[model samples]
Target: MLKGLARIWFCWSFPTMLKGLARIWFSRLTPNSIDTFKELSAQFASYFIRGYKYKKSTTCLISIKQWEDEVLRSYIAHFNKEALLIDEADNKILVAAFTNGLWKDKFLFSLYKNDPKTMADVLYRATKYMNADDALLAHEEKPKKRER
Candidate 1:
């Protein structure tokens, strides 16, 4: 998957995933910059969803495919699962560990109950734009009841 991620870098003409990661890095800033953060979220949404389904698509899937061709397919013939976790104090720090792999370990976790830890689910819930965790970490906030 690292290779897939790498290809996205090239496809998007970015040397690195800095733009996407920046949302996590410099989230503390003036309100003017929040719009930029939303753009970043839209930019990377493809990477998580159907990036390869349409033409153009910011070429995110191209990056993923490129990585699949060069590294992932060769390194990990089998697509495995992995776990991801976030630091309690700082939810931005993502922690990943290996659980399984194919010929070689491509992913860090296996697909099972004891699979590697995951933070994507939780992260999605917490973030408002790309890295908005302020509301998420607020446990004291009351939830609105759904209409019956």
Candidate 2:
């Protein structure tokens, strides 16, 4: 389905292409999109927990919880955009990644960009684990099980 759309999009003229892409991608701020984002975030969280045994994985583990939270918050904020100063290119990349279901690839590529230090720095900067004294977690009530 997406491949066919991608092929068609590839053949579109520049003006039409931007318009089509904007309508298809940036307009997805619905509940389904939120759920999809959450699922994608959990998938990334699981990646850090997979015991990949690589130095990068270990570094990610150090701030895994915070990173996941920030990612979710940032994504949602991008959708809402009340007053946050988010980068347009970053948002476009995010929307494109979400539209294509390439969450992991897009996220890691955006943050890390093939630089291990950059990845570590961004993670560290956003992480709260280092400041345990100021860290507080919201207690979310679990969703009730559906009656059969």
Candidate 3:
């Protein structure tokens, strides 16, 4: 997606490609903590590509409480924005790695060619993780049994 944007960089005429990338990557979130973390990972990578277009975002990264809010869900549904929005407060932050769309290979390859180090930086950030003391979580969330 960003590859598409980069291809059009010379023409300077396609904010839509950027929007497409944002929506594709942003909507993959599930309104859960881990998903939010993953979104952060993706967005950080996109910071280079998206640049100042998202200037009104109050925070560089979103906090967890913002993910749990219902108003955010409603806005995404309303706009038919392929990306998820947490609310009118601008709580959600979408990142490129978290975005699901495929980049046109030529553009991405050109990106790699122009700046190998930048691509490396993006990859390293996406793959890094915090070693917090939080318990290892199970893959499934089971429903609690009803008490008699």
Writing each residue's lDDT as its tens digit, candidate 2 over 1-148 gives 2467775564454225344324443344353443343564574456446733222221222222223335543543343332122222243333333323223534446544533243234435334332432343333445689999
**RMSD for each of the candidates:** 21.1, 19.9, 22.2
| Model 2 clash tally, residue pairs | 0
Candidate 2 backbone collisions, by pair: none
Q: How far does residue 28 in candidate 1 sit from its true spot (Å)?
A: 7.6
What local lDDT score does residue 34 receive in model 3, on the 0 to 100 scale? 37
Name the weakest run of 10 consecutive residues (lDDT summed) in model 1. Answer: 78-87
In model 1, the number of clashes is: 9
Better of 1 and 2 by TM-score: 2
Considering summed lDDT, which 10 consecutive residues are worst modelled in model 2? 54-63
TM-score of 2: 0.16
Q: Pick the candidate with the highest lDDT.
A: 2
List model 1 lDDT by residue over 30-103, tens digit each.
Answer: 44453443575675574446533212222221122223244433322221111111113222222121111222
TM-scores for every candidate against the unseen true structure: 0.15, 0.16, 0.16
